[model samples]
Target: MAYQTTLGWSLISSGIVTLILKVLPYDSLWWGLLLLVLGIAILYLRIS
Candidate 1:
């Protein structure tokens, strides 16, 4: 339950971040790449 809740919130927050980035008139490709890198870093931290 705890893990699922945490995962759900992470996904929700990620989506919110994506939406905010979209609305801010920034470059999509760079924002997406940045998000991808951040996601990978988060996963690496969690895995270790």
Candidate 2:
């Protein structure tokens, strides 16, 4: 149950980040990659 909740929140947060990146005026590969890494770290921490 806890795992599912964490996963759901992570997914929602990632979705929002993606949406924000798309809405931004300029392309930012570095920022997107950084956010992706951060998201992965969050998930890893939650699992551990």
Candidate 3:
């Protein structure tokens, strides 16, 4: 129910923000990996 609620887009936006952080000025692989994993985790939760 939480995901279906009005605030669901806010959750997705957070994930998008995470992805953007990884996108701009690539310097550390670890940072990009962290964002990638987090984005995947968010998508996983969204589907389940």
Candidate 4:
């Protein structure tokens, strides 16, 4: 129950949040890469 509500739901929510951030006006491509990496880290932490 905790995994379903916390990890699963948080992953989905973070994905949407990142998607919105991507659509925002950002001049730096580096930020996008950082965000992608951070997303991966989140998934890794959750699964581990």
The Cα error of candidate 1 at residue 18, in Å, is 3.0
Score candidate 2 by lDDT.
0.85
Compare the candidates by TM-score and give the number of the best one.
1
| Residue-level lDDT tens digits of model 1 in 1-48 | 999999999899978987888786668888888888998999999999
| Worst lDDT 10-window in candidate 3 | 21-30
Candidate 2 lDDT at 9 equals: 91
**Candidate 1 TM-score, C-alpha based:** 0.59
Candidate 4's TM-score: 0.45
Q: Which number leads on lDDT?
A: 1
Q: Kindly give the number of clashing pairs for every candidate.
A: 0, 0, 0, 0
lDDT of 2 by residue, 1-48 (tens): 999998999799878888888887667687798778987899799999
Candidate achieving higher TM-score, 2 or 3? 2
The TM-scores of all predictions, comma-separated, are 0.59, 0.59, 0.45, 0.45
TM-score of 3: 0.45
* Model 3: residues with Cα > 4 Å off, grouped in runs: 1-27
Error of 3 at 18 (Å): 10
As for lDDT, the candidate ahead, 1 or 2, is 1
The reply for model 1, stretches above 4 Å from the true place, is 1-7
